[model samples]
Target: MSNSDSSTTKTNGDQFARKGMSNGHASGMGHATVEIQDGKTVVMDDGRKPPLAIVLKFVDVKHTVAIESRFSWSAKRPFQFKRQSAMEKEILHGITGSVMPGEVLAIMGPSGSGKTTFLNLMGGRALRGMSGNITYNDIKYNKALKRRMGFVTQDDVLFPNLTVRETLMYAALLRLPNSLTRSQKIKRAEDAIIELGLERCRDTVIGGPFLRGISGGERKRVSIGHEILTDPSLLFLDEPTSGLDSTTALRIIQVIKNIAQAGRTVLTTIHQPSSRLFYMFDKLILLSEGHPVYFGKANGAMDYYASIGLKPLIAMNPADFLLDIASGNVNDVSIPQELDKSALPNGNDEAIQPPAKDVREYLVNTFNQELAPQERAKLFALESTREELKLAISEKRLWSITWTQQFSILFIRGLKERRHEFLSWLRFVQCIAISLIVGCLWWRSKIQTEAQLSDQAGLVFFIAIFWGMFPLFTAIFTFPLERAMLAKERASDLYRLSAYFMARTLGDLPLDLVMPCIFILIVYFMTNLRVTAAAFFLTTLTVFLDVVTSQGLGFLIGAVMMDVKKATTLASIVMLAFMLTAGFFVQHIPVWMKWLKYVSFNYYVYKLLIKVQYSDGEVYDCGTGCQSVGTSPSFHGIQLGGGGMEAWALLLMVAIYRILAYIALRRMKTGG
Candidate 1:
């Protein structure tokens, strides 16, 4: 009998014998051969057939994979540096599997069995060294496959702020071929929605955290819908049934099966399954310890188990039975290392091999016999060539919306939010009420005595500390409320960080200017510091400066912290430091510590206000007669000039603080 290897060669040779039989000149020339050289096809022809006429088409796509390691840990180690120290632990051993066109393959394993890891590698999420080959129609696949295949991550990454239609539209716009028109894009999106059964709530918004919109199942569908809109030939889903009830899970699978029947390939990893769910898969790939235990027809799994002399219990789940058999081998129980065809007396082994008279083989043999004519025809019909798919990630963002738009949206949204509204009103009311009550107690300084100087000092000290807290309080409250939303919006590419920051800074200005001015004016009139309008304006400006400075500082802290508790703590610490170095109270500070007063917002505002108020009023002093603690000689330094230095200091301090706050706000808004 002819050896199969030699027979294959002879078959190949004989197949090319009739290539040029139409004329005698090309009769003997039909004999030609093709061989692969240097990983490329090289055709050879004796003076017989035309060398250029010899052609061979081999499918070039492949699914090459190699994963040696994977480590899992919690949030404590964001980079997982420690995990790299131990490289010997291979979470996923070199796993290799592939499916051709019209093939359905399933990966079955127990929980944490690296099934998800395998899927992640296929999706290009898990980084790993890959070997072997995964070819599609003779073409070697690469990252370009991302365009031809769809990946559904474990998490349903949907935006809480957008409706289902909006979410799908955004993804479609980003992923769809640029050549498609707007109407075509919308049509594609609508088709996906209908296919995924999201039409019922297409207009409903997706919800998360404080935002509420759609149900979880609908959200999941939206996630899948986004991917399906791309119309990829290969779809990889990670636990599509996770978090869904069995009924819903079955429905999802049915949808997937429908997709598979429509000439696309779909593969997914599923955990424990009900009997109905188990039967849904076209092929079963049982895995254990990152090794394939069995990969073949799912219906034959039970018989395969029995063939190994492991009898399964009646009515048992076939998958569970096979898993038990694999698990039983964990202790290294001995079994035959190879299949022995001679040992099968009933010829069952030969039945497992390709049947010589099978209809499938007959069809394949006939197709090969007619391949020459088929190719000649296909050469004219093949029109799939087009521009290469290139994913151009945009760097210029949609965040360039003007400050007015950003401010309007943020303020309106902030006002609608219970947390921001409640905190803002409470703080505002507190400021107004305290100003009124303090005004009632220390009304229009009667008899402006020497004791009034002490009162003025007390008033200045209280003003610096209270005003310093304004920025701190605003930051603590605002940061705690909107930090999370900012992060979410940034991730979704909603707006530019700079624009958002600018808008927010501007938005709080009206309130900042109003609150401080009101409190300062109320106090100034009540105590009646000095009647000049310029002095009144200076006093009010100091209060405005305090609030404006605090608002900026609050924004910086809020932007920097991002976390509520952390930001609040940081803001508190900063406020305390500012108060200590304000130089408004306990004027006698260590010389080394005095320099801190220069940079303190509180110090600048306090100094400027005192300068303005003193400039407006006259202080009686007897030359060389004044005695004060720390004054070496009993003398007043040249009669003090009631100067207007406070006005200039107030402007300078406000400008500096606002600038710093703006920089911080920009960073926070952009997730920098």
Candidate 2:
């Protein structure tokens, strides 16, 4: 490899880059040569200029992948669904190309040519509808690698709550080893801050409709920093410079070029690069109608255009030039056929190396050809296994952080977030005050007669419904906001999802106890229920169970759905079913629906309230055959001690729901 001529030899991933490109591999490229006079630039074909750098490499597909799609309703409305029936139109036409390790490989095509689809395939974000052999460093496309490879999605997916530094730090901690001490992590985070030039406003907060965080550039840099923190070998950014000014865009390309020069691969799907950015790339891949028009070194890309009798103007983006050619926007220029060898520069006649048909075999042969047998054996010798790293990651999380950690963090964050919104807190306080005031207005109003008892039952029924819906309010509010951050951390394998769930569950206990405790205490005391110290405790316990169970239900919904609107819809359905089966208005429901009562959390909660409040005596009148409202004669076929056992069963039901919610929360976590 070292013995190759200067025109063919390229640098390995060693040493930093100088201004412009250090290699002279662009000698064969006619459009790459430039001249400078008194700091003014001029396009020239002198053949002595530097070649552009290569930032990434895509060798070849190792296996054939068959992609298929089907539709069920196409025949019913063929005209309406003709286009819809074929969701996938085979965008990438099984093209083969390689990008250099430090080059920006531009992928340009028309709107429907599958540019985004190709980018998604490269990023491993495509679903089962599409299939293809994608390899990185000769390894088949793996999702784990995608984690290390950052994809700046078309939309800037930034959390508006955190500052720029906080956002990057969180991403860093999640991706890097936790074994490093706090200071070490901070240093690493600081390094990224400096590299992306975000130090000016490191603590600037991001902004959104309800959130204020950082500037756009800072957010984008933070996104870039996240991928860099993992020391990723490759990066796939989609339209990174979009929505930015021309100057900012050029600067961003320069930064990316610097990043590539630092021995990492950075491939971005850009709309159009300025001339400056165009010169920054090492390769160009042009596509039309899902077919490759050209795939080669960037400097040589224009040469292919010139070969087809087309002359591109200076300072024009290569993508724009190619598009013009494809769309017939420019007159074609002709290439000299026979006299080019002698007429061109001396180095342009050098042979072009053929691309490897089998990347693995090529690499193997290269390795074998480069080293002696003894050196090859030594290189293959194993020093330490990846199991050690996994174990180390596991060990850092072995510390027994009790429920205290989760409860404390969640409670604090919840309070902070709730308070920051201000409107929600005011509404919540107002509702509690109003509910208490309403209960007081109806205090000691009845329970002496059947109609009076029915009113009391109505009150209890409303309370049960309210409690069942409590978690729904919270889950909808909190989950959507925090889900993105949690997902980012989980994708980096920060900690066990179980630990996060446990912490959240435990942390909310105190706040959960306080809020409902106050509400229940106010209503229980003011409404003039038979209030003994034991009765007060019992009622408070029931309210607490109600709130916790609601929270658990909400957590499960939020965790699974991630979308607040959908979660609310689902929670509403559950609440409605529980209300119907909970003996609200129906003493006898259908047998099938009766089975739902067993699983209905509202049923247990409301039934237990009746047993606790009215168990001692219901003031029976003249053998009128009083049936206690919301009471079950038997639970699991065992009569209550005046049904005190029923209260215990309700408690058990709450516990079970809490457990199931925890499981759901854990499953919602990212990496796990």
Please report the candidate that would top lDDT against the real structure.
2
RMSD of each: 16.5, 12.5
lDDT of 1 by residue, 1-672 (tens): 224422211112223222211111011111234332222324444211111111111121122344445567769968764432333335554343444333445677766556777665555444444433343333444444455566665667654667788777655654555467666667667656655666678887787777778866666667666666654566677787788887777666665654444334667887766677778777676655554555556676656545553454456666565554444321122122232221223455332322212322222233234332443355335332211212222333433234554555555433333334334677778878999887876777632344555566557657767877865676556645665555544533444565556556666666556567768878878876767998787667667767777766776676666677888888787767666765444467788887776667776666555556563234432244533311211111212334355456656766666676666655554322
Model 1 misplaced regions, further than 4 Å: 1-89, 98-214, 222-242, 248-567, 585-595, 608-614, 618-672
lDDT of 2 by residue, 31-115 (tens): 2223322222233332222222212323321222354455445567766633224333455564455554456677765565556
What TM-scores do the predictions have? 0.52, 0.69
- Indicate the TM-score of model 1: 0.52
Candidate that scores best on TM-score: 2
Clashes of 1: 26
Clash counts for all predictions: 26, 21
